[model samples]
Target: MASRSLADFSHPQDFILSILQASPSTRDSRSYLSSFAPPVSVESPSQTPALDVLPDSVPDSASSSAPRTPKPANPLVASLLNPIIRRPALVKIQGPFTDAQLNSIARGMAQLQKLGLVSVIVVDRDDIPVSEPSDAASASRQRTLVLRDVERLVHFLGRHRAPARPILATVARLAGEEEDDTAAEEEKRTPGEVFVEREGLDHIRRAVEEGEIPVLLPVALDPGCRSRRTGADKVLGALASSMSSAAPSTSASGRRTNLTPLRLLVINREGGIPSYARAGLPHLSINLASELDYIRGTFLPQWSHTHPTALSNLALANACLQHMPREASALVVSHRSPAAMIANLITNKPAHSASLPHALLVESEGRVTRDTPTLIRRGLPVRVLRSLAEVDIPRLTALLEKSFRRTLSAEGFYRRLETDLDFVIVIGDYAGAAVVTREDDGTEEGICYLDKFAVLPSHQGDGTVDFLWVALRDETYGLGLADASNPSIGSLSGKGRGRDLVWRSRADNPVNKWYFERSNGFTKSADGKWKMFWCDAEQRLREKAKEAGREFGGGRLARIVEDEERGRLDRWAPVIQSIKSAWV
Candidate 1:
């Protein structure tokens, strides 16, 4: 390889292109980008090449007086590095996985490391016992196993080949009661679990800053200097807690700045937290603050003692997320789709959405319908109110207008407030909201009408819409009628008794595709200006019609079905379309 200085390239993109085009390393395997672009397939052999690529731009120092290089001149370059410049993701991999599965995950992580998305990795050796040894001989055997597993993991990842070499490190402290610890610190500690010690963590941080991924082991030592057994999840949790409140780093101009929050990735046999309501499918996203308890109580039991490890993984994610920044999130994905991890870091979206009603449903015989990663976040709290009277009208109006890019008809909005408003779900000071109302079709049966669904333009793709949709579907609308096992039901069940949720959108709206996936049935208005969608309500009506027909005779079944269909078109459809638009 030719010698090159950071200043050789006038732009960050040029520097990146040069690195990608550099000569290939003899020792390292192909880069993860090989399949995408042949010119960028080479991996640098040096363990600290990332730091060398942009030495003049690295900004953790405080003593130097020289001017630092400008930010990446290209949007793509900045996008790749801005979110993860100083934040290293804590990836905990648990196994019983096949070699192919492990290799795929390693390849994906290596790609992320090269692109500057992740700086460190932590592997959990599920084969290693997580219990205390009965004797010294047992402890010795455990040590040998830990060493062997660490070597295998590092070597495996090494073959996938990242810019930063993977090195094995055992750096943790077993939690214990100590007089020097403060009361607040004591509350955060879990006695007998292992966490990375400050000095050891400094060593790891230095390695990362200099371009290396320290593959941490689950082993740690107590204050007594004796080895203790701990799991990888515990180690990851302790590391997250320490780093979340880590002191500010002094910059080149001597200005101290807080570090970005750390992201987490957990690779296990089970992809994500299960959703029994969706026929044993995994949840797409979980708002940890609000939905964690609901998930643990509702979803985990459905596993039926079959996946105890998955339960622990969920708990680990919740624990880790509580210490992360509000914007920071985590992914627990199956080894099958390792590439989804990289996609998530770059795109910041789950491979599949939790709000898509039928998109996540699983078929019988245990075959997965789709490969979706479960996303977990330290979500904003949701406030569910019975009426708009409790809301700040100005803020609510502004949110709806900004989200829809249209003006709201204040008179029309307030017209239904006195008689039709069912409930309002506001997410974190109106970052998103769903206003539903009860609409009577003259048959005395009131239907749940989604009057408005809005999310701030800035918050759209960062999971705000997905989070709000999940809250609406699971809590407000109530899927409990179809599946009584669903525990999220009745939490705030609005007007209808497990009836269909109906909403309308503009005929040319781009969001119709999203609505189509979540809705069971949809119909276009005759005038062609509006489209109406319902959540499995059409099927519900048909079933009811069939039941009613059974009471009379076989001949009456067809007539009953026809009557039901006719009623939907003549009564419900017109009423749904007749509800005037609240936007001008």
Candidate 2:
């Protein structure tokens, strides 16, 4: 309006503001701005009065007749057309949830969606009774109920100031059922008795690419175009398979959209699969290949009748993990803490370390809290080698050098390993390994020393350390006393003796914090150049000492016994520190 070109204003806001300021007094700011011509060429100040005089009540026909430039679409939304740009996560809500819980879940997921995670939510009506449909009419009725449920879920998630434009999506079809007029085929299997055959998956991918969170309905369309109600777990499994194996689809621009299927998350009332052997507590993590059978055969029998859903969830997760990328994992979390999902997305690990002692996992009620989520993975098998011959010494030596950033004295290491090595816990093709040795102190009971804990540089921060630690501390040559009495707790680890574990590290090492958390107590070398840490087994020893003292009627001899036991850590320090260094 001041005879200024578009170049006069560096920012668009300034240009728009200048227009509002120059508007005629006859028209309100809203009317003037809406009717203003596109900022093509700036006009002289005298010409501004003609455009600003238009009233807010201008007819729609006149406005439509005039050619006006449309505002530019958001670039961020356009960029999503390339699927490779998004991290897609599948979140299934297994529910019979209260209103408050639903609100919380919606808020949490919405917050995550806003943070660039393209989430596809599956709502499982686990509360509904599972029954077979007698006829097409019955199946139709069930489909109607499913539609209602999804509608209500969409409405509720959208209504609560949630900021999520959740659209109801139909992405599943009956498996093995074709689009032909096979009414007979549709009738053979009732609506309630169906498995998902993924259809219209592109629509979902497209929606997510455009920044919409697609809330998929579990209902699948049969060959006859009639809807059938299917199990949510089956739907999740189908989706997982399709999403994980999804080939890069070519966009209109002929560029392939490569969306990665990151994680499969199941949110339920029972946070994770319960460890009935551990007094019905939730398992921190489950290595599907190794632990699935034991859980189904041993643990399922304990809680099958009460929580049959857990089995289905576990099966779905296991299937997902098997099909997904090695880095991808599945989770079964409780609705109580929706944030756990976000935390896992960030850390790619369980909220709690899987190697925590069973005694420490429980709350005052003697059961693991319902909020503890179980991370399910297609983890590599853990192997324990008692003899050096079982291991590739050169590879082990290379790993130690790489992880420690120092040369290993192969001669000294092998000598120590030959004599004192209790067990070597190796995880997944040398991704991580721990060397445990029986230290010879003056005490009658030998100390279990963690000699060398090494994880490949490429494998660090992805739970390899925790997985290997679980093997060394709980699975093989056990340390925690609670696990000693309960042999049925872990898989394939004939050892859970719950003996004391001690380890030493350079005083300046960064891993000391992590070691400190896992240990019961620690002490520094007299030279302060080395620090030693011990686990709960030390507490067990102290308790035993107190019991012995009580048995002796608290006499001078009992006092002497207690004093010696209290100074046991001090006595072991010089012996541990005096050992020749393994690194050259």
Candidate 3:
């Protein structure tokens, strides 16, 4: 590596090019870019159960401990077992990054580490490239690098297990610097230098800019090691690639097919940053300070403060999404992401919508639960039906008309429920039923919309509806239809776990107050006629995960809602495995 000034590179885009392409000279011996590419395959049909009416008696697999191993033909799990060629560890070190900030970051990292989500490295500002103390007399006084911290902890953790060196690529950076955008700008200046105030870090930043020599992360790790790779835990949601500039492909979880290269480079600039920093850099320069605030407030509620930890987290997400050789676009729906999240299948914050679909939300007078609470009394039991096999259409029609004082879409309603219905929770003898639709909008709104929430006029003022809702909330999500027994319904139900259990009510409806109270939040669409109310299933599910001391997020949310009846779960495994890996 011939040393040159950062500004001296005749071709300004050289370093960024090396990183995105994983060039031969600097690329890892094994290929990483292609490992996460969606596998080429034909569309296999989904084996959802036949949608015919079922008899009353059926077997339950809730407690059945059956082996779910795939047949010999199954190759998906085999992909999962592929030896890790290289696990990318993204870490950033900074100056004036206090100890308390590190602790806060450590908490989030510890959570991910427990979930096998990521490995972190925090290099000290003075040890930018990880060098020893120049003042040898006191050299042993401090172990400042985050890698050392992680290694020591890993060693402690592995004491009861096998010893191994995790083949990881540690990409280092300073807190203030996010990307090359500032340098590449026409009005060129160092974004990092301006943001990073500490004198120690400023010097290191100048060195790389002036030196022009690239600091590469791939070659530093032991690339030949074939051990458990990093991020094996997120195989379901973890889509990765080793190439830097591969354009968007359809989304799917691919098994690691090849171990090729890991390539990224950094270089020195002229005394003043050379003309190249503002040149053709491919990725976005993350604004560390700004992004950290969003992450703190959104994800880690307990430690919701802007600090060094948040900057380090930004680096980690950058490594996982931005830096991976074009391998992450599938899992990372970052079109307009607010924070650097692992994935954004379900979110409490809804995307702004332009058009509101046509779904009827009628306001009807009903008994207030708090005013008069009612449980399903004695013989009038709460029945959870999967289909409308036993439904009485006339009675249902009469009930809807009487309650809303409007014409009922009896045929449309039945057809919709028959085709799109997920599950229904009804009061004793169908006094009232809350119908849930699996495909409400047939788009990524990913809502378990309240297709129909009605109680017969006979049962309205007596609190049957209130009792039904309470039971539904306790047993299912909100609207109260489905059960936890079959969570694999996630694909049909909505995106993963934090799906929006949503419904609309007229702005002036009396039920607006009740809907507002029960939901996480709502949005008044561009059209003022409707106010949408929603309960974030994953939000509550995340709370449940915390209570159980478990790793929270989409993964757990997807698992908890599985249908556990009659080997439905076992049947769902192969289906989920394939779906997780399916490319668009």
Candidate 4:
């Protein structure tokens, strides 16, 4: 036999190789070395002998056969005199052993008893010994107790508080068993049923009241039984009903309304009239004096018309009629020209005749020129005035009252007239001599009402006449007179009735058929004059409808009429029948 100390080897590999070399004759040694090295095959265990025994030549200190002795108890513990010391037997039983496990436990307990460690064995529900017999015997002999399960071990420790062996291992084993039991209990519980366990019933009640958990309603029909089973559901239903009843209705009236009144003002120069009325604010008409030289020199020469002054006055009067209030009156202050002729014409005209009661004629002192007198003879209710500065409140008030009364019966006529005409133009001051004429109404029905118009030699080639004609056309369209029953025309219905507009120079005169034709009037009569002119209400409205595409005929007329207005006219028969309560 050969032997060597562990420290004598220079390296582990060298030691292993040296051992193999020394035991060359031993087949087991050769086989072990061959297995340890790479690229070398070793036969299986069935072909090899087991090397379980060691040689006896090895020193006892280095061998597993060294003598064993029991460890002595600490002397310090006796000095302290804490308590009597004793050893408690310990026995471990492996689990998953079934009946075999039980037998092993029994054998361990017996071993402890033989060792004088315990006197009895206590088994658990699993048939594993809670306190093994061998362990109990050892404990009894040594005046100590040993228990396996934590609960039982704790009970034993409480019953026996005397000095004993360390209980760390026993405590660990017991804790493990307790943990396993807790895991099994947890595994048996369902996910949905799991909930945090509160300490008190009051806490649970509060949680329910705060809606931390949903209330489940019972399907039972019995009210009392259902209420008892689902208290949360009943409470929630009551709360919801109460809340619904407490809610406010959404249909309350809270919208704002418009209460502001309307105001309008119209001025006519024909009768030197100024009409004022008010709804919220006053609609006042202020007529200014016309420039006669501009009319004669710049307007008259362009158009062939007799009685230029009369025409001028008529034009002024027409201007006045267009702006006359349907309910109120007009104050006419006569100045330079033939005021009576203009006023009489306005008072006699069909449109103005009805509203004439609303018109007051105040004779003004005629202008003093190189050809006439400074103070002309007073004719009808004439007032002598040195200048415009002489106008007084009393005079103005008297005129206003007289005009108001005169216009009473003419309200309807004035209203219709207002609907038919465009804007009113007041040539001269309201106190001046003027002319009034229905614009564009001249050539429509063969009645040509020409106003003051002339062409000035100086501005003849300047296209002033053309410009004036264009201006008249634009004004006609803008005032809705170009198309009757148009949206714009409908805006002039009520008190805006008797007002009239004026045009002075022939160059700017919209009444002339030739001028009208030149400006795209297109339609011609047998005399080659413009036939499509706005004169009476019916003609004006028909022309308006034709232009707006509301007429029955196609081609130019249909394109001119508006689709909506046409639809309205088409539906008018049914509407009329409905008003009469008769089926159409």
* Clashes found in each candidate (C-alpha, N, C closer than 3 A): 0, 3, 43, 81
Q: What is the TM-score of each candidate against the true structure?
A: 0.74, 0.73, 0.27, 0.15
List runs of model 1 lying over 4 Å from the truth.
1-86, 96-101, 163-170, 181-197, 247-262, 299-305, 364-372, 389-394, 405-407, 474-478, 482-496, 538-562, 573-578
- Rank order by TM-score, top first? 1, 2, 3, 4
Candidate number with greatest TM-score: 1
- Full-model lDDT for every candidate: 0.59, 0.59, 0.32, 0.22
Instruction: List candidate 2 stretches off by more than 4 Å.
Output: 1-84, 129-131, 135-138, 160-170, 175-199, 222-226, 249-257, 300-302, 361-368, 475-497, 536-567
Model 1, range 129-219, lDDT digits (tens) per residue? 7887789898888767666655666676677554444444457788676534546755566567566656766756565565456676676
Tell me how far the alpha carbon of residue 495 in candidate 4 is from the true structure, in angstroms, after superposition.
10
Which has the better lDDT: candidate 2, or candidate 3?
Answer: 2
User: Model 1 compared with the native: what TM-score?
Assistant: 0.74
Tens-digit lDDT track of model 3 for 158-182:
4422222332332221222344464
Q: RMSD (Cα, Å) of candidate 3?
A: 23.1
